[model samples]
Structure formats: C-alpha cells, structure tokens
Target: MAQQFVDTKIKGDKVVLFMKPTCSYCIMAKDVLSKYKFKPGHLEYIDISGRSDMDSLQDYFLELTGARTVPRVFIGEECIGGGSDVVALHKSGKLEGMLKSIGAM
Candidate 1:
C-alpha cells in the first residue's frame, strides 16, 4: 500500500522529500533542506509530480499524517511539514538539533 511505501521510505531514508517537480513549495523546501549541508547520498528526493500513483499516494499521506501538500518532508521518519514549516524549524534554531539527533550532521 501507499502508506507502507511512505513508512518504508521515511524510516529507510534519512531525508525524504515527497515532492512535485513543478511545485513552488517543493522548490523552496528543497532549498531549505539543502542549507543543512547533509552529506552526499543523505538527502533523497522523490518527485511524485507526474507519477500515476500520486493521487492515492497523496491521499494516503493526508490520512497518515494530515499533510495534504507536496514536499512532505520527513527527517529520520519524522514528518516535518512543507517549506514554511521547515523554515520555521530552522528559524527556531531547532532544525540543527533535530538533524544532529539523527546523525545527519
């Protein structure tokens, strides 16, 4: 199921971005995540924009985490919301700690 894939990817990948290639928010989210300077191969971006399964996949995401938008950023299995949320985390000075907690830094 879609939920299974999401869970698997979130847990298996240190940084997972369920994004849409043409989404502005996705672009911004990518930029924000890039600021962390994660080691090579640490950041894994999954662009689901044109994927035929995106609808069901997104629905599953909404149901699983109440997140309805693209760029569903997950850090070490924790759903961290979209671009604004990521920025908020960084601004609050908590993003680095979270990254370090997961050994991403």
Candidate 2:
C-alpha cells in the first residue's frame, strides 16, 4: 500500500516530497523549493508523520531510496536526497534546471 502510494505520487512530472511536518530537514527542503513557482498540482508534500503506516512507508522508502529519512525530495521520478542536498543543488544552480525539465517551474 505504501509502495502504491509513493509510486503513484512520484510517477509523473511532479516534485513529490515525503516529509514530516515538524522535521527541521523537511522545513529546510520546503523553504528551498518554495522559492520556485511550480505549476498547479506539480509540487506535492506527503506528510508521513502521524500516519498509522508510517513505519511501513519509511521501510519502503529505505528499500526504494536507500534511506528512511524525511524530506525525501523527488524531482519528477528521481529521488534527489534530503534537505542539505536540495540546498546544494539550489546553490549550484541545478535545481532550477531540474524543475524546468519536469515543467514544475
């Protein structure tokens, strides 16, 4: 079920963030991404905190992304890592290009 949810959410030309509302890393990632103008419905935040199946979801994330960390930022169908990673990408001027490629900006 978790797999299905994640797979469906990340399948298209969208930026999907699997995050917890209170996570500092998640906040950082969100702050960076929010600087951009995404097409409607192109940027999605799936809050994993307080969910009954959160552990299973994180397990699936570990299997799929090699990490169970929040702020799992996906640019289109790619897992672009966590908050610091996103900041790095933004600093390098590659995040915008990525968003542009997926038509999210």
Candidate 3:
C-alpha cells in the first residue's frame, strides 16, 4: 500500500517530497523548493509525521531510495536524495534546469 501511494505520487507529481513537518532536513528541502514557481498542484509535500503508518512508509522509502530519512525528495519519478542533496543541486545551479526539464518551472 505504501509502495502504491509513493509510486502514484512520484509518477503523478512534478515534484514530491515525502517529509515530516518537524524535521529540520524536511524544512530545508521545503525552503529550497519554495523558491520555484511550480504550476498549481504540480508540487506536493506528503507529510508523514502524523500518519500511523509513517514507519511503514519510511521502510518502503528505505527500500525504494536506500534511505529511511525524512524529506525524500523526488523530481518527476526520480528520487533525488534528501535536503543536503537538493541544496547542493541548487548550489551547483543544476536544480533549475531539472525543474525546467520537467516543466515544473
């Protein structure tokens, strides 16, 4: 079920962040992503902090992404690692191109 949800969201959205509301890394990711102007409904943040199945979802993410960390960032069906990764991408000036490629910019 978690896999299905994750898969659907990743495939359907231009940008998706499987995050926890209170996580510092999640906040950092959100901060960076918020700078972009994504079409309405194209950017999604799936907060798992309040869910009863958060652990299972994280477990699924570990299998899918090889990491159990919050703020699992995905761009057009690609898991782009976490907050630090996104920040680095932004720093390297590659993030804008990636967002543009997927029509999220």
Candidate 4:
C-alpha cells in the first residue's frame, strides 16, 4: 500500500531508488549515486521480494514509470527508469547535475 511505502523508506526523500538486494545492476546504481555524492539520506531502495508492501507498490511504480523493472528511480517524483538509464545519465555527467539542480545532492 502507499501508506506502507511511506512508512518503510521512500517517502521523505526527493529521489527514490527501487532496487532488489541481490541485483548487480542495482548495486551499480547505488554505487554510482553514492560516487556522485547523492549521500545516505538522499536515496531510498526497496526490495520488492522481501516486503509485501513493496511488492504491491511495484505495480503502482510501474504504472507511473511505464517500466516493469527493478532500480526504477524517481527524482522529485519524476520517474527516471532502470539501471542502464541511470548509468547512461551518469556517463553523460548529467546525473549529478540533475541532482544538484533538484537540490538533492
């Protein structure tokens, strides 16, 4: 439920990272975000497999993002897609800029 996601971890931050625990791409995304100084409190990660609320919320997230994949990110409620997309943004040196623009980094 939305309330559950709000209660668990993603509600406060402007950028949320929906990721799985054992996913390599997810790990890389986290690393990249950290390397860019996104910092600890600036990000949120959800493991859909472990939490029932997250599993249910994935549908809503997919509906918003139009992508059924882990590592679906949101910056100020803007859906930013999966890992490859995040990596691409980072590679282009635009990811950090975007975070800065949003006052998230």
Candidate 5:
C-alpha cells in the first residue's frame, strides 16, 4: 500500500509535494516549484491538507522514504527529501536537469 501510494503520486504528477497546505516549509517548496517550467499535464497545485488519511499517509511516507515530514517531495519515481533539499538542488542548478529528465520542462 505504501508503494502504491508513492507510485500513484509519482505517476500522477511531474512533481509531487506531500505537504500540508499551511506548512511554512511547504510554502517555501511551493515557491520553488513555481519557478520551474513544467509541461501541460503537470499539476502545479494539489492540496492534500484536509484529507482523512493524512496521518496514515505520513506514516506510509515514513515507511517508504524513511522520513515522516511535510513537504516530502518526489520527482518522478525518486524521493528528493524535503524543502531545503529542493532549494539546494535549485541553487546548485540540479533541479532543472531533473525536471528535464522527467520531461517536466
């Protein structure tokens, strides 16, 4: 079930941010994502804040990624850690390559 949850998110969006809508770090992540030039099918925003399974989903993420934190990010099938990681990649010019590799650019 954890794998399925991950698979669905990775396959469903070019960049999936497992985050709370009001999380400060999540907001930071969102700001970073907005700077990218993703393709048409990419979902720019999909809020998962008030879901009934929110807590369980976080648990599943801990099992899947070894981290249970908001702003858990996925690029394609790869888990890219949290907001700071994303910012680091962006600053290092690595995020663009990742986006291109996934055809999100």
Candidate 6:
C-alpha cells in the first residue's frame, strides 16, 4: 500500500492532504478548504493512524518537506506546509493564486 501510494502519479490537479481521520485539526483544515468551494477531486487524503502505509508516507512526507504534522499539503509536487500555513495563505488571499498557478484551482 505504501509503495503504491508513493508511486502513484497523482492524477490531474495534484493536491494531497495528509492527515489522520480523527484529527480535529485535519478535519478543520479540510472543512475550511471545502467551504471555499474547492471540488471534491481537488485533494487526496492520506490517513495516518495505525496504518503502516500512512506511517511510511508520513516519514517520507517529513523527509520531503521537513514537516512533522498532520494536514500537511502538497500541491502539484510543491510543499504548501501544514494547516496553519494553509489557513494563513488563505487569509492572506494568496492560496487561490498559488493554487491557480499550480493548475490545482
């Protein structure tokens, strides 16, 4: 599973949301994004609880982005940081532009 997920070339409009299912922070982040009317297919949710695949993915995510938190996002191979960063970008009116630039919007 880990290998498959990692190897996956993320179809069109790449956006990944790495989070655990029960994490409120994760849920909030996703909710906020949804509230913005982002389409359902705009993001990929990788849940990391007891799943080894997720654990491995988390490790890779950390190594790749130097972040050790849930709800870390990647837009088209670009690390967009964690929930706070994402929300900050949205509040600053930069999120949409960034997404658009990356062809994720």
Q: For each candidate, give its TM-score against the true structure.
A: 0.89, 0.97, 0.95, 0.81, 0.88, 0.79
lDDT (10s digit) by residue, model 5, range 1-105: 545655676863488888788888888888898898788876445466787776777888888789988888888767898889989999999998988888777
- The TM-score between candidate 3 and the true structure equals 0.95
Best by lDDT: 2
Residue-wise lDDT of candidate 3 within 51-96, one digit each (tens)? 8888889999999899999889999988999999999999999999
lDDT of 6 by residue, 25-50 (tens): 78877875665545556767767687
2 versus 6: better lDDT goes to: 2
Candidate 3's C-alpha runs over 4 A off are none
Model 3, 97: alpha-carbon shift in Å? Answer: 0.6
lDDT score at residue 12, model 4, on the 0-100 scale: 34
| Better structure of 1 and 4 per lDDT | 1
lDDT of 4 by residue, 1-105 (tens): 654563355443467787897888888888777776665577666666677566556677666667667877777657778888889999998887888877777
Give the CA lDDT, 0 to 100, for residue 33 in model 4: 76
Task: Estimate the Cα RMSD of every predicted model relative to the unseen true structure.
Answer: 1.5, 0.7, 1.1, 2.6, 2.0, 2.4
Cα-based lDDT for every prediction? 0.83, 0.92, 0.90, 0.72, 0.79, 0.72
Cα deviation at 72, candidate 3, in Å, is 0.1
Clashes of 6: 0
User: How much RMSD separates candidate 5 from the native structure?
Assistant: 2.0
| Deviation of model 1 at 71, angstroms | 1.5
Q: Residue-wise lDDT of candidate 1 within 1-105, one digit each (tens)?
A: 777777778763388889988899899888888888786777889988777778888998888779778889888887888988888898899988888788776
